[model samples]
Target: MRWNNATTGRWTHRLIPNLTPWLQRRHGQVDFYLTQMISGHGCFKEYLHRFKHEPNPYCDHCGTGSIEDAEHALFICPLFVRYRAEAETTTVCNLTADNVMSCTLESQSKWDAIANMAAGILKELRRRERSRRIQS
Candidate 1:
């Protein structure tokens, strides 16, 4: 599905019933909330625009240079390379159905940690912008 706006252009997503549950399971509830906050659906996009960094809204770390969407925020961001690496390591041990289910069931704390980390990274990025502005 796609939604078009005069300012932000187009947004797209998969039309699947399981998408939300899958997101909550994989990324955790805090990440989901942060995604909603950033996307400005609960509020106005214009109001939320201040939170976004410039240069095409891509993954802050990877520089994928596209719209900064939820998937990129959760999985693909190069800034969270350490988190991804940890997840990869955990995946080896937690490769069973029971372990996967346990992880999903206990995802809230994990999500909180990730969300906090992301918030810190974003704050640092904004701080860098402030520094650059001062320098210039």
Candidate 2:
């Protein structure tokens, strides 16, 4: 099957097969982060705080010490535990940055599965954020 389209506006038919070996590096991780728009950092909190909107950097749902960073949203949050479990089922992965990045550099099939899981988590995150906005 095809990969890296519908994920992007245009199809990248020739890029999928060869992208693996490159994704193991820092630059590759950044590329993946940018493409996913979830940097596993405090990007979401910073955006809200930049607008004077979020008030505190602590998570809205988890009440954790850290902000609602992408990692927290995707992996640490109890709210998305079910979704994370679903993602785990795809690879049964331990959910580490190193693991994910290495996986991306290994197999196209695994990478596609990871991409889909990440996209699904982000979709749910967006839904929650939108709902919060509406409620506010």
Evaluated with TM-score, which candidate comes out highest?
A: 2
Model 1 lowest lDDT segment of ten: 9-18
TM-score per prediction, in order, is: 0.37, 0.63
lDDT of 2 by residue, 1-136 (tens): 3346545323122223334455444332333433554333323664566667666667777675667765566567787677657656776577654456455545555555567666666777667667877998
Tens-digit lDDT string for candidate 1 (99-126) = 3323444455544544454455445444
**Candidate 1: residue 124 Cα off by (Å):** 0.6
lDDT of each: 0.42, 0.56
Off by over 4 Å in 1: 1-18, 22-33, 36-106
For each of the candidates, give the backbone clash count.
0, 0
Against the hidden true structure, what lDDT does model 1 obtain? Answer: 0.42
